[model samples]
Target: MTTPGARAEAGTTRFTVRSPRAEAVWLCLFAGEAETRHAMERSGSDWTITLPGDLSGTLYGYRAAGPWAPEEGCWFDPAKLLVDPYAVELDRRFVQSPLLATFGEDTGGIVPRAVVPAPLAPLPPEQPRFARGGLVYELNVRGFTMLHPDVPEALRGTVAALAHPAVLAHLSRLNVTAVELMPIVAWVDERHLPPLGLVNSWGYNPVAMMALDPGLCPGGVAELRRTVEALHAAGIGVVLDLVFNHSGESDVHGGILSLRGLDDAMYARAPEPDGRLINDTGCGNTLDFANPAVRRLAIDTMRHFVTHCGVDGFRFDLAPILARGPGFDPAAPIFAEIGADPLLADRVLIAEPWDIGPGGYQLGAFPPNWLEWNDRFRDDVRRFWKGDGSIGVLATRLAGSTDIFGPQRVGEGCRSINFIAAHDGFTLADMVAYAERHNWANGENNRDGHGENFSWNNGVEGPSNDAAIIAARRRDLKALLGTLFASAGTIMLTAGDEFGRTQQGNNNAYCQDNAIGWVDWNARDLALEEHVIALSAARAGNLRTFAQFPDPVVWQSRDGKAMTVEDWERPGADWLRCSAPGTGFGFTIDRAERSVNIDS
Candidate 1:
């Protein structure tokens, strides 16, 4: 198949786009305020135009003409500026407007233009820097460095900020194997957010798959490539968190941004009678993986990052949607397709592993080579620390979730990315500081985030002035962090979690791009940060032992007696220690004192 999007040649550039249902497609180029629309010739399902002169850095977009039936999934309005699906750079960020939805309203003034990318020599294929069963640090690029004082003011809140010495030192201190960056791709604010004076802090609502968001990554692909190279120099890998299940174009009432205007069939639809768009991702519309064209786009997007940016791997948000052909198929063709692609075959693949669709909760359903975000580990660990969970269940999770991933465990290479908290939920500090979610600021009447967080405030609900309450919260935080570091698997630590960063109890601060969302580096808990540093160093030194639950292990009581099944199953059993010979490691969890002692 011919590569889609603009390709610069010796003296001319060839532009291609796939709009099978469109009767006609035109390539619109921008020079200053003037725009030129060149009609493209159709060959099969694709539209092409070979323009005179190398058009690198030129601003361009597409306008397709076709049927406008939204119900049957044919949205092609020439007035709507369509971003190239394979675009790697954009002149500006996306914004929401009602004009984007109204037919023939002319969104040329509102929509962003895709920039013709300069040709880059692909990186020599090398083994990924990330290793299995290593610490995966998750972070939002903008939020992570937005308020960092050490980062230059000019570079704050951008991908370039990640290459700062301060940021590198922090990641190195955590002994991070890979930094799983949250969505950095171009995304538009949700329609409801502008009215509320809020913006999407999380880039989950993506528009173009390959284009980097200008706000977050001002230098485009070059900025990302530079950052990745710097991180590699620091012995840290880079994994992008990509959203393939849905697009920011949203539902029928939403905008005709890119694929929707070019090829509406790019989205999955319900069985004919009504033919409504599938809402599997709960992000309005689900990208149709069943369509071969869509699969090609997904694969091509992965290749672009790996070849151009030299990223170690990707973490698929709402990954179950990748396998859904209306129903979840364990043997989805995408799994085999990615495995077969040479550029992506060795790249680390992590899956969120669930969506809102039927059978979406496919915990251990991904291919063996892929690592899955273990939400079970999050909830069960939270439950145990909250004091209502079973020790046996906690033990299973700490032992690598053998029930979910099959018995060939972490000792061999665990498939679980264990975490007690992630970006979607409460921060690790809030888990012990706020019993209930305080998301009143999200403008959804305090009802936007998860209600049952399995959280427990020590004494007071929000902040506390009492020294005892403060001490207790710190102890609980240490216990939780210790449990995570001691767990058997590739553990993940969300940025700012090493120190104590809070959203003022906002479990879902996805829209708070301000101080409420930014990490308060000035007010960080230094002691907690040091504790995490120690844990990270110990985990790195004893990685072989910490990667899996030790065999020939003895579960002992506080008195050092081998614990019986009765002791293991005892209700309110809070303390236990485990040790194995020759591994040079042992650990004790004493929930009564809110502490975890790691000996390695």
Candidate 2:
């Protein structure tokens, strides 16, 4: 196979590919009304082809002829057209199409031919100014305003909706200082979803770390810039949830996406003991940060976000995986460099400090200046207030979890990111409404979500007209919010938790891209929204109360009893009065007031 008049030159428009294992490869191009098949030339393990003019907006795929063997991770069937991992533009949105197949031998033999367009436009200027001590609301873009009737139908799913007056009004009223939009980077549905008639809603499986998903940015970079500027004008910051721990491309058996094609050796492969790919992320393959080239790629991606997207911060998904080598170490070179980098050092760096890898739990081990998602705080507070445990764990968590975070690195004066629920799991409403996970919609039976929810259904599995259960659920929600705000650390709230959004007991609603996960603006409970607003107001009114440095909060129980270590361990002591010595305010709570007291 050979491409006629194909040559490599500085200004020449030609693409090259090489697969020693393939007998032939063809470049299939959608040129006007007809499909043109051009044979590609092979050089060693590479193949080459060239187009006469710009191929912008032209649909293209590749065909490679080779044997198919399912067991050994080689499924090369040239009959299927492969998407280019580095294609800057996509011709179609990802619909549930079986026509898109993953099984192909010589998968790397084909590439999505790059579409030539006018010279790429320069990115928007960065907005570096951000308000200090701002409350950040973590939300899924599609879930935040997608179902709201107030948002224009065309703008609902795109970045344009974020700037709509209705959306801005909601954020302004809630007094959110920042809106940490979940991963909006270009991503793909997990391979299992299309076959199951499901779609990826979380955007965690990113294919391109630098580019925003076109589907979400219909108006492109200009629209995203407007949204960011709108947020900034309203005194709010914008943070992005980034997933550099791995790519959408799974193991060798997965699709041939970006990183896998640019350089596979840069990724972490199973060690010499097995020589397979390490599956630390549970999503199939773990990125090999051990390789310098991979490290550079990750750093470059971060630079792109900071330099181009104007993001004020980044919340790293599966951050612990980024610090792992043959063993887990908090002081890994990659993390240390990031902390020292002038561009990223001062930016808000939050880590989801655990992965499925060995010794993956590094809860409080992240370096100074880095905030970690306090899962321990989330679990303990839930259990204690829900009447399941001694208050000892809650006491430790409220003080920033010195036990798990270790007194050495994260003393009583460090800031921890505390939250009860995030986008990955159940909403606050479902936490108290279901004991068992109802993830049947995910097509993996009921095994797709975590089995141990540490949740109590309050005597009902889901929605109920019973007054007692409803009241208890509401109180619990308030309590959870209160506890998060009162804790001696930074607090974060899931977007719809304030108004009581429920996934109907589904803890893992990652693939339900519809109403199950979206916020219902029409059905929002005004009273509850007010309660959440009041909580935010209280926090804003008394920032000193939650601050950790300078002095620790001193408390005394109502019966003239000091809150000793033993008092925390005691299971029967429900009503206790706590006082912040330095801040002049004291509050008391039995089990019922825990919701409002802590949140407010």
Candidate 3:
């Protein structure tokens, strides 16, 4: 099962690849434009070759001989050398060339080559600390500290910036258990971005899933290890947001990147009649994880991160795709394997819970030990605070949405992750000030981004000069923060949301990696930051209020009387109160819950 790519032995190195469709496979070595090809022996689904003498630091690739029929999904081009699917390191950036899509041409100098590094050391002993009912602060690698003054000028926008004393101190102050970093894996710009003169800073469109982006991790895995070590020393954990649903390679017309060039069968292609790609993700190609080889690739990639880079967990983007056979299933092989894997059993797993594909909104259907982003909680809380409904639904969300998460309450804390804003949508500030999306700068003539953002403009659409409107907006922001903290589930806060960071109402700033995306640290609203700090500390002090069981909630009406079923169904009844024991705090709409004294 471990046989994949170059692995150094006592005095020799072995190269293995799984190409079920290829008739023959060759191990090609490159040295100063001179090439040497060695034919590989076939063993079922694996093709392998072993070479003697210490063969570390060698640059190599592979070529498979087979059919070249794209219409039926067998794309085997012996001339267009392929990258090892398990390549740990790439020598340079993958330069896009039109010749890569065609067959039978010696692409000697242009294709990316895999590097065999010296033997790696074992990872640190696993001691994951992320679990239920803790805070997770999500931040972007480059944009997080790009403008921080304390970070070194050279390392301002790299992974190294995260370990800087200033950044670590700030994280420590927030009391979050983990930092959920956005995609750090190697990715490429979309084909359309070049004509519009834009860059892909989000790194979601990944080509090499295992390789870390050079711009972020220049020293490769060593840099990542150092950052992880630093965070562990500071009592913080790292959670990587991974995107394995699709690759940077688009459809047939798009460029042939890593996986597609190696084998077209790796993707989830449509059934007969059309034979087109199953674009479940908004991205062009969805990986066929039902294939054993692709499943192995994904498992091996996660193992490498855990055994080499010391990552604590993974937050899968568009997670439903990984469980697709004919349709999404909770018992998908990948899920079963991860649940049973020794290395991953204790690691925290989170899911974005939906995609553009059919039957993709499988929110509470994930297996146990996995957490999900609660969009229902987000929307309900937003609508309630924005004056669309009563506080009844919001009360349910603050109690961990037992009706949605499950009445059983199998886990100790909560399975839902509560948040008012995230990366794809508007910031906390923009959410309160924008009635509609302002994505005119995304080059789509303002037609892009979500239509219903659940946002309110307070009175004016954009920036306001009225004192009453400003005060109300600030109050609403604090109320939202309090509700998030007072909730029973894990709370999430974007990097710069505490001090009112805004993208000028650009709900979708995925492509605008300029001032529109980076956190403006210089314009910190100190008052708002301090207020959030107090809210966080208060939340921590009152954790006992949310007991482990789902039955901790005891609902009451505005008059402090127990509510009946008729009261709950009453359309006119708005104000509600929910109380729990030990934490001495109460969840109420118009009034604050009295903190009970233990002395009594």
Q: Find the candidate with the highest lDDT and give its number.
A: 1
Off by over 4 Å in 3: 31-38, 78-81, 95-99, 102-111, 408-411, 542-550, 564-574, 591-600
Taken over the whole model, the C-alpha lDDT of each candidate is 0.92, 0.70, 0.79
Which pairs of residues have clashing backbones in candidate 3?
545-583
**Candidate 2 — worst ten consecutive residues by lDDT sum?**
105-114
Ranking by TM-score: 1, 3, 2
TM-score-best of 2 and 3: 3
User: How does candidate 3 score on lDDT?
Assistant: 0.79
Off by over 4 Å in 2: 1-89, 94-134, 406-413, 544-550, 592-595, 598-600
TM-scores for all predictions: 0.99, 0.84, 0.93
Candidate 2 lands at a TM-score of 0.84
Residue pairs in collision within model 1: none
lDDT per residue for candidate 3 within 145-224, as digits (tens), equals 88888898899878888999999988877776789999887777777776787777788888878877777777778888
User: What does candidate 2's lDDT look like per residue over 444-538, in tens digits?
Assistant: 88898888777888888888999988898888877777777667667788888889888888889999888888888887867788988887787
